[model samples]
Target: MDNDFSVDLDDILATLRSHDIVIARFVTVHRRLLFDFRSTPLDPPLVAAVDPLPSIEARYRHLRELRPRLGDPPKLVTVFWPRFVASLADTPAWQAVRGRLSASGHPGAVESADAALAGLVDLERAAQREAILGGRAFRTIWSASPSPR
Candidate 1:
């Protein structure tokens, strides 16, 4: 499985080719960011729809590779994708996560998929959730999450 994503230090990817909007879910019980999200761009307005994950195995394989880059062990985990809904991105949350990523050296760029998936986090913390999914639509920004989650 040459394409299988088993992230390693040797494979430190500077950028991911895929564009799935990773809704930074929240810190899990183990203190890892729970990045629950779908593979394809959800809101059509944010980005052009992409093909769904070829299979569950493909989805998990991505998670396995992405988690290490997010932190280390217990860094991130793609929790799950909820039902279809018109969720909006929280300005604060989106910026906060983007800032965090930026500080980590992977500053996320503003994009429609990022805006669209900004509010799709699965968090119990209302304020935090609001920050992540708050504010007006970021239609002005231009970026694309065209990969599978």
Candidate 2:
């Protein structure tokens, strides 16, 4: 696991549980699986790629609305590796979301999130290179390129 891409699963679970949100994990190899979590075997919602504006927005809205009710912020944990570049490149929705996020102005939450995500990509790439040289299985690699905007 990349230190820059660290996510405390236990903390996330506690936060979700505090808000009465059930967390589930599912293992699938399909992009469309993101459309409906229920259709998958995962229990706690897992974050893979930050794409699909409508779907992401809907989920955010749902969690935002649930926050007050649950008395805590909704917890979402996502893990991505170097291969995210190819995977995301193949998805139009992912590209669109990436554009929107990268275009966000500075001095705001969006900017901060964008920076953090970019850092995670860098770390993933480094990890992938290390794995390749070590003769290990291909790991997910995320090529972090700064937005030209």
CA lDDT of every candidate: 0.32, 0.36
In angstroms, the error of model 1 at 40 is 24
lDDT of 2 by residue, 27-143 (tens): 221121121111112222222323323554565675545332333333433332223433333444334333443443222433443354454456546656766665355554654
Supply every candidate's count of residue pairs whose N, Cα or C atoms clash at under 3 angstroms. 11, 13
lDDT (Cα) of model 1:
0.32
Candidate 1 similarity to native, TM-score? 0.26
TM-score on alpha carbons, each prediction: 0.26, 0.29
lDDT tens per residue, model 1, 54-132? 5556645655554423322222223221212222233333344344333333223335435434333332234344445
Error of 1 at 84 (Å): 8.1
